[model samples]
Target: MRFDSVPMPTAVQARPRDSRGYPVPAITPWEGAEPQFALTDYGRSADCARGRLCSVCNELMPRGPVWRVVGGTESAAIAEALEAGRPYRNLAPTMEGPGHRACMLYASMVCPYLARPNARRGRTADGESELTSHLVRGTARGGRGAVVGFADYEFAITATQVLFRFLDVVEFLPHADADEHLGDLEAELARRQPR
Candidate 1:
């Protein structure tokens, strides 16, 4: 299927609102090599029940719930790992988790500009480049370190290895550019949808 002409639903453009209909602000996206705080902190800011916040511009996130794509036993395993409080990395290898694979694939597909090492140079938001200094090293307890990449916000392969976490809470500058990119994505998806 051709994924090149679907329209983004208007709902995707709906700004998150409080009871009063005012916009809520998200925490600013990370700005340096070493994280200003824990990874969970960033996760909380982006995903907390309070509301969707942009990690980059510190603005309210545009409304659209995460669209999870999981298949087969991998889906069940991720849920199980989350419930067990065991790290996901321990389970990823066993299932060859499709969710993990999908996340990486999606990242590579959607942000082709980021896949090239040299492409990332000088790509900064507020003086912070696209890359984060926090490298995923071997875990002290067990399992491998979760690798994370950022284009707008933090995207990480969770330690559990069961899920690929994408934290796209940043407001890209040149709003028109972002809208254009979204239009392109929507068009692509529509093209892929079966007739």
Candidate 2:
């Protein structure tokens, strides 16, 4: 007796969702990076949660909530801007974006290199003393260091990392205190870092 050939059906699971029941979008599948010499690879950004994907997970931020990760001395300036009722609409000197608290915590625990000081290494067009004075006094203005809020933001994928250009400052609300958050992050980094 000859048996008939039949294909088996595969079981599929439903995608994950947040507490609100909105579908959670997955990160775009990696197609493998191109060789450096062959061609440049500027990563692409996807719009999500009225913002953009988190830099680490590439997942859309949850609606109505966001997290800002500050890695510099501009926290005081940002707080001052928010306090003084400034109408500034750019977070240029900031490396923050919409993110889940868990994701941010995981990144802080895992990435030790990011915890290092990242001051501009060399002299700028204004000369060494100018940059040194700025670093020393922490009075350098504009870019990520000066801006507090943005009306909207443009996300970019560069050769090395994701960028958020906060534009059109209508209002700025600092969700977390910079000094406390930085101290917490530093403590966590110290604990997590390999000796």
Candidate 3:
């Protein structure tokens, strides 16, 4: 999908960008050294958890519907509902904190690793494959991502990632929908690519 055509959201634009102009996610650690996309900063993550900062841009989000990028298999609650032949109404816990919807959408459309199906999640200092936890490696099946929104969420801090217990279901954009948007975004980006 193309991404260059769409106007970047103000919050996304405020984020730090890479040399290639990709926004460096707020949760990504950067303390004067080169940014590591695979890692999350403890302090930064704590701030986001407690300060209501967007996980993608580090911007304060209004106390309302917030979005999270979920991986495969969903949560245990969803699984149980399906197992018991019951319809589920609420989203479960996610490993990451919520972010501004705009930043999440921009990320879903343009971030190479998050957008591309086969993109590497991370590389070690030697440029070798670096897959640590399920959080960094993304979905278990190595598939596309989905943006799930919640009206409010509960959180628990861990050393590796922040856990979010989603309260109310606001929006659920699965991989197929995201792909459609990506297609449109890519076409736009392609049109604007040649400057």
Candidate 4:
């Protein structure tokens, strides 16, 4: 995928790119000098949520209806609704923070594990993805992740994690297509429908 093709928000544009030219997410942890994509910097994450900052860019959001990439068991219903192109009411506390729609879109397309539906998250020798700031992360629970939007969110900070409760919800929409696979996915979806 051409990294330049990703529609970057202003803050995302300022981020340093990796060897492949993909912008490193603002909250990804740095181990020594390199980024460990598998880990989240909890301090920065909380700050982003608390300060109304974009999770992807780590800068203050300029608008409402924050978008987030939600996955795993908790996001099942929302994911299903999005795939079928319907709206959903979110009554659950969102565990992750807010991000710009464009930043989240860029991430969903550029991150291989996220872009490819069944791609496995690589693990290290000790059964973790990576260890620099290793937290006990769970594998994808057979559900494809979705980019959801919420007008506002309130923090539910605990000693271990930060969560968000979305207010004034919008469609909990999933990806129409991973940008890199647009052509193939469009054809594939069309093939499944009765003509």
Candidate 5:
């Protein structure tokens, strides 16, 4: 199947400044949550640079699908931790930290399942009917209160498929207002096509 390029929708604009009127970075099209693969130390040119595949399950394990959790009341504290490169863990509902006042970025990847056409019900372990794989990305969540931002991508096809499927099932939080932006991107892509 041929893939189409979809420009990110930009319904949400960046904040101008806080009560102090300082400059704030404008939000970009890539700020939304997406699936991503982990990058190895070898960099993109290396074969394994995309990340490692599990031999047991034939799953790709990438570094992320990070969640950036910003502390509503203490945005500065969260920013400081991110800059310092401090490690944090993922705890559903709320991600705790050494400092309750700080924000958090939770990163993780979803597993992929490839179903076999001939697989029969109850024939496999756990009644499994498909092969599973992994996708990774480095996630960072930053904002204030419970509001957060997520950014990710899938470097491998196996991972990408899983992410798309997941999106199909679950509604993305924040419900980005990208209708107009998406319309423009679609038009741009059509213009660029070879025809």
Candidate 6:
């Protein structure tokens, strides 16, 4: 609940102001790589206002449990765990930030790779899907808004969502899907696995 892992950057230290005392542009914690997907136009408010914008609704990510989609190699692991209905805890995987539950649910419903079996199974021009999909939940590391980096997080899983701690790290591994609602995910995985 408390995010003591990474100290919040002071206003002068992180969000410097101009002559008018207006906050300058806010920089994302992920300086190296940007999230490939953009669910909302004002998602940057999470970085600029630090908790005033929701990644899903383009509103504020709110001060409570926020749901963020996962990418990267860890996404594959989390995706597998989700399909298998396994309990994933203390897994500090990287994420963009939080969003409203309604907004996130909408994403899960419309997202091609996340919701559609065909899109998830279809290969791209290079003969691969070229996308890793995951849905994770998180809370502010210490404050009421977003976090600055991945290291400032801890992870947990529930039947409905995956909750993250403010700060913690863990290894990622592949998982399986046992949910029947996933459609042909299992069959699709079987088809993709190397013989």
Q: Using TM-score as the measure, which candidate wins? A: 3
**Every model's Cα RMSD, please?**
14.5, 16.1, 6.7, 8.2, 19.0, 18.4
Q: Which stretches of candidate 4 lie over 4 Å from their true place?
A: 2-4, 72-75, 79-94, 123-141, 180-195
**lDDT (tens digit, per residue) of candidate 5 on 1-195:** 001132311211122333333212121111133212121111221222234332111124344332222222233443444557653222212211110000111010000111111212221111111321111121222222222322332222332221111001011122112121333335534554566
In lDDT terms, which candidate is top? 3
lDDT of 1 by residue, 1-195 (tens): 111222322322242433433222232123342332112243444243234333322334344423222222333444455567643332222111111112222322322122222222223222222222312322111211122222222233343222224332111111111223344444545664568
Superposed by TM-score, candidate 5 places the C-alpha of residue 138 at a distance from the truth, in angstroms, of 35
Q: After superposition, how far is residue 17 of candidate 1 from its true place, in Å?
A: 19
- For residues 1-195, what per-residue lDDT tens digits would candidate 2 score against the true structure? 000111101110132333433222233222343111111123323333234655334555544434443434554555666579764444453323444443444332222212223322222222233212343322222233221323445666544444455554443323222222344444544654468
Candidate 5 global TM-score: 0.18
Off by over 4 Å in 1: 1-117, 121-184, 187-195
**In model 4, how large is the Cα lDDT of residue 124?**
26
Model 2: CA > 4 A from native:
1-41, 44-51, 91-97, 116-152, 156-163, 167-195
State every prediction's TM-score relative to the real structure. 0.23, 0.38, 0.70, 0.70, 0.18, 0.34
Q: For candidate 3, lDDT tens digit of each residue in 1-195? A: 555554576666777777667678888887575677766676788889899999887888898989876544453444455568765554444446788776676777666555555655554321222222344443322454676677887887765556667765666565633555555434544564556
C-alpha lDDT score of every prediction, in listed order:
0.29, 0.36, 0.64, 0.62, 0.22, 0.33
RMSD of 4: 8.2
Candidate 5, residue 171: Cα displacement in angstroms equals 21
Where is model 2 poorest over a 10-residue stretch in terms of lDDT? 3-12
Q: Which of the two candidates, 3 or 6, achieves a greater lDDT against the reference?
A: 3
Arrange candidates by lDDT, highest first: which order?
3, 4, 2, 6, 1, 5
How do the residues 36-129 of candidate 6 rate in per-residue lDDT, one tens digit apiece?
A: 2322123353242354454444444434454443333345544455578774432443333444433333333334343332334232111112
lDDT of 4 by residue, 1-195 (tens): 555665555667798776667677877767776777765677877888778888788777876678776654435776666678776656665445778766676677767656655545654212222222222344432455666667777887667566667664474545434574444334534553468
